[model samples]
Target: MNYDECHTVKTICGPHASCHNTAGGFFCLCHTGFAQLSGKTNFTGYGAGCQDVDECLQQPCGPHGVCINAEGTFLCSHMTPPMTSHLQTTLSPFVHCLSNLLKDQSIIDNCFTKRLQQPPADQFCSLINSTLAFARRMCEQKGEYRQKSASVTLKDVTSFGNKFVADGSGVESATVFLGAMENFATLAALASPTQELKAISSAHLDLDVRVIDVTNRRFLAHERLTLRAKNDTLDIYMKTVTEEQQTGASVVVFLSYTDLRSLQRGEFVTEGQPQSHLLTSSVVSVVIGNRRHRQLRDGVNITLSHTSQTQGSLSDWRIFCVYWNHSPSSSHWSPEGCEVIQSNGTHTTCGCQHLSSFALLIATSKVTPPANRLQHHGILPNPAPIQNVLQLRYRMV
Candidate 1:
């Protein structure tokens, strides 16, 4: 049949589409930037069979821009560049202030390298920036005063300082300078794990911390430190305290163990048996204030050290600070404020809070009763009573 005589059908292609008819079949073709509604290259139906092509799927705008799809076309919107110039101007003073506060060369180098080269994550950047800003403000506020006696709590400074150190790549020298300026109390408090000590033993211990100025040979600050230690192990605690005025200040800690059991029993052990326990280091000068020029703060860094006369023995030997408590009925030693530091083991470095009169108590290792005694009593002898008491006492130097 001829084309005209075959069939005269109504236009079936939708808008933006062209319809082509051959002998007996007709097909719809969508125009550029348009597609068939059914997602086909071509269609044969009526209605609005053509739809705008989603150019967004191709991401024509690139990485730093947004693509907005429109009728038969799409728009590319580029993002604004970051305001680094303004940020750099604002952060310069704070960066300088932080650098001045940090004395360690390595820490200073690391801090600047990472801060300038690598962009920190948003959260950490905000934290460090805010902290440094606060420190700068503090320095400014205190600058106007003539005496410069303005006091800031160590707790407040330490909270931010610790966060800065931790997020600033764990700079040890920076931490030390911050600790020294804040009066070493935070370091001392952190050195002794109080909660862990409470769970270990019931023995009562008193700690004291002192700051000595080595340059001028004088005592700066002396205070009692709340120290906690495992009751089972011989623990020593030390911290260095420094003030703004003091540069070469050293912290001296004196530890003294209190024998609560002996105090309760109205018995005081004064002299310790020589072979009962071991003494490794020679008894140094017991007077804390004697060697004013000798700096021992750095020397005494170990917070806890454990030594047994015989290895793997369950019984723990204790060193006590013994001084007259002046109670008429009580003969026990009080380890409150004596000035003697003593250790029973050799090559052992002890850290204590303050100087105090001290004594040693060597505990008996054997706790369980003999098998014959257990058989006769039809039960094991009560070990708790024997274990709680100190067996021998050694004189303090």
Candidate 2:
């Protein structure tokens, strides 16, 4: 080889007999049987070595596996598919994906990381609670739509001045207003005595109550209703019982009407105070404590107040009507006809007969007061009696 030519390749004195060339220098390179290993060659003085190249980036393997190039050598390896996907492919629909993943937790966690972290845990829990509370308010609002008299105010649980605040240690006050509002729904344990509710206004014939509260000792929040009755019609001003609370609290409520009639007979067949028909239905109770709260471990108790107009012509009747299982599912109270169970003052159970849903053939009679009575006793009649045969259907469930 030429001594001055940079392009010439010449063999060095080292035992490795390879030759290579560079600018103004000639060096030994790998022979046909070998290739230079990586980092083996460096330019120092006149005797440096040539480094091997990694062919892995060039994908030297059959394109099905990884290629790792080493000094004068290389290796190829096949990648194994994930076990989950492997089973999915092999077993088709019969694959037991959970069993495989449970045996290996890391694989499952890595796969689901992005989906699971979309919403933080705290935000998820808060969203759930908010949804439930919103649903309760919506149901209550719908029920209040049917009230005839007396304004109802929906109170926020946080708006009350005397609300309970939990301190991880112990409750500061023995009693706190978990929530308070007009037409608020309450629920107590089903076993509690139903007759313990406070009567806001009681009329022998008709009644009107301004404020009613029923907080039982059971720590449940139930319904408390303030009502105004006119003529033979009753206006309800209260929230609809929520689906969850309805089954837990059952009470005996009373509703009084002067006469009971049957469409088949078309005549007044009976007259008296029916206690069974009056008391069996549950009335709305006011809940003063949070049913969901724990430390006020005991349920809440409430008080109710009523306003009576003794001088009015329709103030004598204080009646509470009971409509049981009123919904589209109720087949007993049909539009064509329904049964009216009447109980006289003397009998515990009243007679039952079929009548139209809107059939009220009862006489428009009046209750005569005592001749020597000093106070003016007024009897409120049904303001909107079902006389025109406009039969309405209600479900039981």
Candidate 3:
């Protein structure tokens, strides 16, 4: 039997469909991108015709970009560089400003106003070290490790005038610098630390001066003095001279300062004035001799010694003075002047049992007191006044 003759069937077109035959089975089908309308079929009826599917209507690309329909799948293309994220974009301005400030702050107008109250300590250390380095450079320019044993003489000590005039507190608080010296030359390298200074001779002349005010209080000037020496250790004779010292013997061995008596005392400046000395500690000058820690006797006048045997840069041979106060609170006045009197029912006020009662009040008289107390200063004269205030009275029947 022939296949065509065995099963012969006539196909009729239905609604919204095209007919296809395969392996003796016939089915209704629609073209690609079109859906078949189900059930009955007529030209314009429900299943009679295929509907044209709109690819753009679906909008599969989300809201950010455009979606293109291809043969089998859809292609999503960004309309613009994917728009910056709202969250990240919103913070861009803040990040930019912070980064700009971190760069050269010259453009920032309020940089100084926002500066920290105190610069880091490391900053001060760097500044001081730099200044020392400059001095070391000057030393290297002259010579290195010039040793003078018998009679050491130094010259040109005036070159380091500014360093010598620094305040005592600055010098004492400065980090100790240890310099690496050249073997033959006394001149130290700029990068090295400055520790012990070299001298020319064994019996060197040491000159020291303390600035004493009218009240007999002494202040220290810069402690490190410029001196020329042949070795790291020894005594050397030095003379302080200006550029003019070359022609004359005007090498001043000592600088004598006499305090001028000022009539101003206990006078505070007007309010709103800039603070001239905030956070700065009061500094005192202390003289140290051959001993490392021993202080020279008070009231001793330091002067220059005249001697014949001297050679080399005698100008830099000035005594190295050290600045220090007894303690951090050394500026506090000792409780000696003030007095306090206690009050009782009979006498109303009397001296307390302590010897310092009177001293406390006197010492504190100058200070603007925060409260009403017998002692205005740091010292307390008597505890009886406080006791009297605490006593209680009761009515009896």
Candidate 4:
């Protein structure tokens, strides 16, 4: 049993350090607010570079609070709120300014883009949507399950923005994904299954959270719940009915986001006209768990998986299954309640019926772009065979 990759070995560790793998070899450490400079804690070879310690020298936020620091880390901010996280003093300065604007170096070399850079990655997804609008107000903090829910408040704040992700919830049980496309509130935890059985998963969401009856919310009669996810891209089937106790998690949720399209680029209108799609899959959000499975008479059967087929056109890419709306005036992505049923080039089989947040767009170009220019993708017209559909178009130059 031989292996490698202890970070591709180039002096192994030095500048600000960070290896960590342990038990079967691996260790470097020294990032969070850094140290090393030789005041050693672990070393070897080109090991040792980290320094930045001053966590505000020592004011750890006592006298009227306002630390700021920032390098390894430090940012108490304005202060006076902690009756128990006044939402970490109003979203911890947008997670410490998106973890220090991704350690800026020209946004770590133009935001490690993954492609489809809309509106020039809208100022890097508007600085990661200021942590996705406080991760959608921590998923609308509904009802009660306290202990300061959220697996016990950000479960040891495990690496954000820099992208590691871990939550370890309050009562115990963590692993909350808040790095890319992070929203839907630090994903309220639930691993407890004290028999009454069914599924509810993570790693990258796997569905079917069966077992209802929180006082006969009904469903254990002929039980029906099926969900599939673990990479192969996507596949989900739904036909659930509730009622079954031993309760813990049943606010009914089944999320799967690989970048809730961060902030969806090229958002083809749908049901309101204006088309020109290209999302091609990487968004699956089905929040069903009663109120009659969240308004489903018979729908919720998604099956997307088309990140490409040589990039566009299976009869002009047409697909659009959309959802995720708003109102205080208006938000967007509204295909009215979805229904693609079948598509080709790779996959597409939706049937939604009102849940929330979903995506599939694809129809890349038969031109269509007006509607105040879909909030600027540089007013369209680059048309040379869908230029790989908005070639990761994030423009701020």
Q: What's the C-alpha lDDT at position 388 in model 4?
A: 18
Number of clashes in model 3?
41
- The ten-residue window of minimal lDDT in model 4 covers 388-397
> Candidate 2 — which residues are off by over 4 angstroms?
1-133, 136-154, 157-311, 315-327, 330-364, 367-397
Residue 321 error, candidate 1, Å = 22
- Model 3 worst lDDT run, 10 consecutive residues: 177-186
How do all models score by TM-score?
0.25, 0.16, 0.20, 0.26
Candidate 3 is scored at a TM of 0.20
User: Which one is best on TM-score?
Assistant: 4
lDDT of 1 by residue, 43-107 (tens): 77764567667666787666644443333443333433322443446543333333433322233
Write model 4 residue lDDT over 1-397, tens digit each, in one string: 4344365675577675666655566667665555775677766545555666656668776664434343343333332332232344544433333332222222212332222232454443444433433433432334221112233222211123213212211110011122222222222222111223223234433333332323223333333343333222222222232233232223344434444333355345665776655666655555432122246554455555666643345545356677656433445566786656555566555666556656677565554422211111111111111111111010100
Winner of 1 and 4 under TM-score? 4
Residue 378, model 3, lDDT: 28
**What C-alpha lDDT do the candidate models reach, one value each?**
0.34, 0.24, 0.23, 0.40
TM-score of 1: 0.25
Question: Which of the predicted structures, 1 or 4, would earn the higher lDDT when compared with the native?
Answer: 4
lDDT of candidate 2 at residue 248, scale 0 to 100: 18
- Best of the candidates, lDDT: 4
